[model samples]
Target: MAANMFVVRQTKGTVLCCKCGILMAPNPANMCVTCLRSEVDITEGLRKHATIMHCPECDSYLQPPRTWLKAQLESKELLTYCVKRLETDLIKVRLVNAEFIWTEPHSKRIKVKLKVQKEVLNGAILEQSYVVEYVLQDHMCESCTRFQANPDQWVASVQLRQRVSHRRTFFYLEQLILKHDAAVHAIKIKQMDQGIDFFFANKSHASKFVEFLDKVAPTKRRESKQLVSHDPKNNSYNYKYTFSVEISPICREDLIVCLLELLLVWGISDRL
Candidate 1:
């Protein structure tokens, strides 16, 4: 009677790992942790050596196939660019962490350490880390390349000039341009003795810049167009536009001073 009163309990079953023959819970690959990690390559198709296209002239990097992006040394943007380059292969697993392994700036090599995880077995996650070295390859960005090809080639130009003894007016104008992002379409911004030159590939962009200057600064605007070429068949004419912006020569703290002797000779100051 006592022997018939006992409750029956079932123990969990186990299986042997294919390679190591270690007894473990049932899993998809039928392999232990050590063997599965060694066998499975979560970082497959990821290149150990990568190339990042950089513009030596502008100190910018080529983002993917076409876009040019400016990124500071060891900045988050640079790190994001590195990670995006590995996006195709990294889709296979989840990225845990990625950080830069600092190297000399002059070395032109960026090292990124990546931690990735993959779940190959039943409820078992495998994590691994590896470093990828990115070599900066000299590739001129589109703007710089175009500029080098033809420095004078532009459809529109903005000649920004301030006729003042100091550069404070130009400095303020620069801040306004940055605030409004007025020069987004500018091909190149050049510092000139007179002031700054903003070149563009489109006439509309130059006109926009002139409008921006009108709103921000007290300036006079002049426009001129030069005929570049003509398509007789299409009856289309190509012209290059130029917008001359001259900021006022007046200063906030300036005073108009006349000497008493000079005023006496003119007999104007003493008339009041």
Candidate 2:
């Protein structure tokens, strides 16, 4: 019988913490023990230092330095361009943050998680939030074929909490869904029930509208479709296709829009 073994030796050298200016003994990755412990801080320093700014209108701290924010905005612009370049039935594109939290001392360095939503449809959840890094959430609308003219329109209402950031994101995503030719026709929005009611001209329109809604819906682990009824006075059959989504709260708009688009497209295809 034979035994195989190896001897380990410690190499001595001075490693300095990028921050705090502390000298430490040699270790793995050329980082000092203390620096290694505070890896996130060290990485942040390596990147740009974010500044915290206050908004007089809202009295809230804005994370990420102005420069960093500008860069991020520019990146988003680039993404929009790229999405536009893709030749598909997809009419809209959006980037959403799921969970955004401001740590101590308002620096532009925000803890942000991101997601992407595409087309959507009925009985689907469009937006979702989770405490994780970047995740992808996408949807596609079913192809629209038959369209009716001059149908009666009705409004759907829901309540939403008032918050500038979330509100802005939601509106932005809605506009994106509107970009679709089929989803755009005969659609209107009104504020009611603490949220907003999205109106459509007919059952088909409402079905298409729900598709767009799904795109912006949140992500959910277990989602099931439910059928909701409209008033009997309209002289037409009315129903709503509903579903649940799970995702990070910050990126809800994106998920909702994506789900809506998928559902709308699916409905159209089903009719065909």
The prediction achieving the highest lDDT against the true structure is: 1
Clashes of each: 0, 81
Compose the digit string of candidate 1's lDDT tens values, residues 118-178. 8865656778898999999998987778888998778999999887779877777778776
Residue 119 displacement (Å), model 1: 2.5
Best by TM-score: 1
Per-model CA lDDT versus the true structure: 0.84, 0.39
Candidate 1: regions farther than 4 A off? 1-45, 70-77, 120-122, 126-129, 175-184, 249-272
**Candidate 1, run of 10 with poorest lDDT:** 251-260
lDDT at residue 229 of model 1 (Cα atoms)? 95
- What tens digits encode model 2's per-residue C-alpha lDDT throughout 86-191? 2231223233543344434333233344343422332221332223212212211111111123222233322223333346655655577645543444344456
